[model samples]
Structure formats: C-alpha cells, structure tokens
Target: MILLLLTVVPVAAFTPWARNDSAAYVFRDHVTGVLEKRRRKLDALRRKGGDAIIRDAVGRGLHWNALGVAFPRDARDDAFEKFAQTVVAHQPVDRAMLRHDTLAGRRLTAADHDAMRSERRRLATVDADQIGATGDDARNSRRRLAAHDAGRLDATGAAIIDDWGLSFENVTRISLKAHAALGREARKQNLTAGVVEATLLPGDVAAWLASPRLRAALDAYLGAKAYVRTRIGALRLTNRLTAPYSGAEPNLLGYPSGFWHHDRCGRRVKAFLFLHDVKADGRPTLIAEASHRTHYYEYKDLLQSRFSDEYISSNYDVVQLVGPRGGGFLFDTNTIHKGRSDGKRGRTVIIADFMDTRKLYTFKKLRYRGPCGQHRTVKMGGEDIACQSWCRR
Candidate 1:
C-alpha cells in the first residue's frame, strides 16, 4: 500500500497540472509557497538563522529538498520518460527557422559594439576588491547599519536588508541628462524596451550599469567579501506608459497592478532605480512588510484571485515605495509584492538583478560578446566552476 501510494501520488498530482502549462506554473508556485511556510516554521522550532535550518532539512548530498519528495526514484523516472515519449510523439519538425538566427531586424548597432567592447574590457580586468570595502570600512558600515536597523537612525542599507529584507537607499540621484536619455530611448523602442526580460540596448546598459553610485551601494550592501561572488543579470527597464490599466484579470491576476509573487524559489535580490519621480498614481511597487520572514495567507489567495481591500487592511502592512527620480529600492525577491500603474502617464524604472552563487532556483547560460568579438558565456544560477572564474575576474 505504501509503495502504491508513492507510485500513484505523483501521477495523480502532476498529470492534470502538466496538461495546462499555466496551471503547472500556479501549482508549482503554490507548492513552493507551502514549502516556504514549512521551512520557516521548522526554522523557528529549530532556532536556526540565515538559511542554515532549511538547508539542513533539504540537503541530501548535493541535491535540493524538492527533488524526490512526492515520488520514488523509479516512479519519477518512469513519469519523466512517459512525458518525454508523449511529447516526442506529438511534436512536429519545422526546419524553416534556424536555431542560431537572431531576432529579425535586431541587428547590433555601433553603440552596441561600443558597449560590448566596454563590457568585455570590464569583465576581463575587473577586480572584486576594487569595489569591495576594506575590513575596517566594512566593520564601520556594519556598526552604522546595525544602529539604523534598530531605528536609532534613519532607514539605511543595514536596517532594510539585514532585518526587513528590503532597502530604500536615499542614494545619489540619476542625473537629469541620463534620465532624459533613457526616456528618449524608451520612446524609440516603445514596442520592446520596457517589458520584462527585454534585452536592453547597449547604450542603456552602458549608462545604468556603469553608474558608480549603484556599484558603491552594492558593495556596501554585500559586505567586503560577499560582493566578490556576485553576478549581474537582466538590466532591463519597467515602462508602464499605458496607464489607467485595470488589475481585474481572472487568469494570473490579470490587471495593471503589482501581483503578489516571489521572483525565485531561492534567495535573490533585485534592484529598481526610478528614472523619474514615482508617486502612488505612478503605480509604485507595493511590498508587504517583512513578508519575506512570515507567510501571509492573503498572498496565497491573491495569487488565485484579485486583491481585496479587506485583504489589504487585515493581512498586510503594505509599504508603497514612493520616491523621486534617481532614488531606488533593493529587495529580496522572496518577499510577496506587486507593481501596477494607475495614472494616465507611464512610469519608467531601471530594473536589475544581482545573483549570488550562494542561492538560486533556475539555471540559464549567460553569453556575451567579448571586446575582440569573441564569445563569452557563464551560467547565471546554480554551481559551476566557470561561474567562479567569471565572477572572481
């Protein structure tokens, strides 16, 4: 009976879930939500800190805790084989589009060539410690951060990131010239530049990624040594120009609001630099305070349905992140949050993610063109020797 339950469970659960890829996403997210709750509960009981407790519970050799939970090895293997077989049986061959072809009319420009060249030079000669603080400086920053975290001072990097898993740094502003340039570029590429995972033009990347202010803040946030293991991913923009959008969609919180979702299953931090002044009407990102540490039921419900006023009142200490142009926030992606526009005009932000080798969920190979037009590649997530070389360099 035990063996039968193990054999039948995965089939019963995942079969329907797999039929609709959309449903599969929902199911997977729901499972991770439950797991996150369980892990936190277990952590409290064990009195462990800093991912140590959950790591112990989930680690089986090098594999994570999710690998073999609902299925026995043989059963899971059989299920995957059957799924692959069914896919192969149904999939059709189409040779008209070559895999190596770039997107139509997306040819690289002179600025792209320049940016590529600059990026390669930076990567090849970049020193981690060049951006890192000395030991004494880090210690001093930590002391100041601790005070700020305790509310003895204004909110700073230490207070938000160390305790709240968020940072609203009142850092240096993005210059008016740079902001206008970004806006102009957005207008030129209105069709593609502002969406999620949109490949940034070389000029945009060169401007934002090369910001000395951003680098300095990141250095302070990651500490001296921790900053060394970091890699930048997805330096894209969030453009919400078509405002007065509704967040009333039934399927996947269909609306122009920030839906509650974690960025990844594992630990990751993302940053958003507002290129212009952001107000409530601009559809600023709403974060549930400390939702990273505590599981809120409203988050679960909101995922399946629409956001309720009652739900917001009862469940969340919602933090509407409103700030001026050049100001920004950095936050742990594990927190449940949403962003939506409500005004007539759209708001634009420079969005970027900083991934540490320490925590990850999905893995993707990152490729870049070198200064000499040579191909360079590194994996974004998961453990890889090549990533170590790349990050360290």
Candidate 2:
C-alpha cells in the first residue's frame, strides 16, 4: 500500500509540465507502466500466502533490468523496488495465510478509488495542454535567440531583452542601468578622484570636424602615412604624432608636440602645436605624471613608492575658452590632453607634435647645460664662449 501511494502520488504530480515535454513524457510513461506491472504482481502475491507473497515480490523486484537505461528502466527498477520493499515489510501480517487475508483488506474504499481515477484523468488533461504550450514557447525562444546571436541586438540590448522581453519600460531601465555600469567602469579606468568628467553628447561636435575643407587640410598636413576613418560611427584621425625624446627608437614613442611641460626648473615650455581647433573650451591635453622624476635613474625609486601606474600630473586649463568648439593647445609629455572637436559647428584645427632627437647629438661635445644659459663653451674649432645663451642659472 505504501509503495502504491509513493508511485501514484508522484506520477500524478508530474502530469503537468514534466509529462507534457517529449523527454519528460517518455520517462513518465515508462515509469508508470513499470509500477502498474508491479502492482499486478503484488496483488497476485496477496492471493497466495504472505511468506509466499514476500518471496515472489522480492524475486520479481530483484530481476530488474540491469542495462542501466535512463527513464523507464533506470527510474522504475531502482526506485520502485526499494519503495515497495519498505512498504511491504511494514505491513501487519503474520506468516500463515496473511497474504490472502491482507489482500482482501487492501482493496481501496469507493471514495479513494474514485479520487485516484479522477486524479489520473486530470493529469492526462494537463499533460496534453502543456505539450502544446511548451512547443510554442520553445519555438519562440529559438527565434529570439537566433536574432540575438545574429547581432540584431547589441551587447547591451541583448542582455536586457533576453532577461525581459520587448517592453519600453524594461528597455529604458536596462539602458540607464547599462550607462551607470559603464560610468563606473570608466571611473576606474580614468582613476578619477573627484567630480565626474562630463561627456559630450553624441554627434555634438560632428559638424565642426566633418567639413570637406577641414578634412582636406588635415589630410595634406598628415600626408599618406595616416588618414581619417570612421570607427564605431565616430570620425577620428589615426596618425603617429611625434613624441618627446626618450633616447629610444623614433617610432617607438610617438610624442604629441602640441603639448606643454614643466621643466626641472619649473619653466613652462611649449612642446608642440595643433593645427585644428577643439570646439570645447579649456579642453586639456592629457598628461600622466610619472611617479619617478623625469630622470631615468629615479624610475625604480618611484615604482617603489607605490605611485600609480598611470598618474595624471596636470592638464591644460580650458576654463577661459569661449565655447566647447575652440582651438586649444596641449603641453608636451609633461601634461596629457586630447583635442575635442565636438563642442561647436564649423570649428576646425590642425594637430602636430615635435619629435625630440637631441639625444642623438648628445655625444657631439655639446655639453649638456642647465635650463638657462650660465656657462657657455663652443665645440671643436669654435672659440670658448659664455654658456649664457644655452643654459639658465
């Protein structure tokens, strides 16, 4: 009886989504068939003696399929046998003719029989309904998943819609959430310490740099080594700008000449010039402060001091600029900044940087002097002269 209760109750509960699906239905049917066959065997045992019944039941249960198949065979043989044994052993029956007598008592009451029949019928109905519903759901899910895989939905859009369908509220909520997440990541990358840096709206400065005349000028200045290209819908020029002299290979460090730097003497030196006007006012040239002093020998000490890998030392002051679209300059390797052409319309400018190759001439007897000329000397055939013109005190 207990074994029957376990088998019937679970099968009834599984009639909905579980039995409706193809895989689940196959498993369910196989298990149910096996249980019914066992039930008949148990009933026959009850007609015989109790000891005979136990022996017969155990023999039948032990001969279960051993191929270890899933669903029908595995589920029934393994699960049902153990369950039946536990139930049969607990029955209050003596060894003599108990099986036959108990079998008579085991017949279900009218209400119980009717209830079981009704439950079985209800399960069949639910399983049929679920089969149709699940098929439709799977088809729709596949279509949507394919569309997403084909790039019809971008990374941000796909993530949002996949979890929540095409609802306006969901889209908007997801977009805002994505923007917030990106902003957080940017802050980490930028190592921003204070207030958030404002980002210009998309296409805000497009008109300013999109003119044919400006493009022509930039092309002429930049030459064939580089050109402008639209990437991710943004108009940007790619070129190797000259960089400060690091006593290394020329192309290895492309320095931006349109920059400024504070020399060891704290004197502001203009490093390069830009050919284009950035629309944004006070748009600064970006600079990363090396934790070490400019001298190469101090680099190891700087690294030891826990200086940030990339530190922002200074930037151009754009506060005085009239508007977002305006010509601006960046100091040399000392300070870092980039041109912003998105601030206004019809604003155009050129960009260029100076390459420092003084290291190549360092061994030519031209003594290295301080920032200002103090003591001067001529080389080779030239006469000795005061270095006042080169070195500063």
* Prediction-by-prediction clash tally: 5, 39
Clashes of 2: 39
Q: After superposition, how far is residue 360 of candidate 2 from its true place, in Å?
A: 3.9
Give the TM-score (vs. native) of candidate 2: 0.17
Model 1 clash pairs are: 247-255, 249-254, 258-338, 258-339, 258-340
Candidate 1 on 229-305: residue-level lDDT in tens?
A: 23322222344433323344334422323445544222334567665677777767777565443112222132432
Q: In candidate 2, what are the lDDT values of residues 1-393, reduced to their tens digit?
A: 998898787221111112222122112344345345445554554555433433443444322111111112122343333433432322221111112111211234566446434533443344345355454453444334434432311111111111211234433443343345446645676732211222222133333233222222222222211321211111122222222223442121222222222222111112111223333332323333221112110111111111111122221122212212222222222122233222223222222221121221231124333222223232211233332344322
On lDDT, the candidate that comes out on top is 1
Estimate TM-scores for all models: 0.42, 0.17
Candidate RMSDs in Å, in order, are: 15.5, 36.5
Off by over 4 Å in 1: 1-198, 201-249, 253-257, 295-309, 361-393
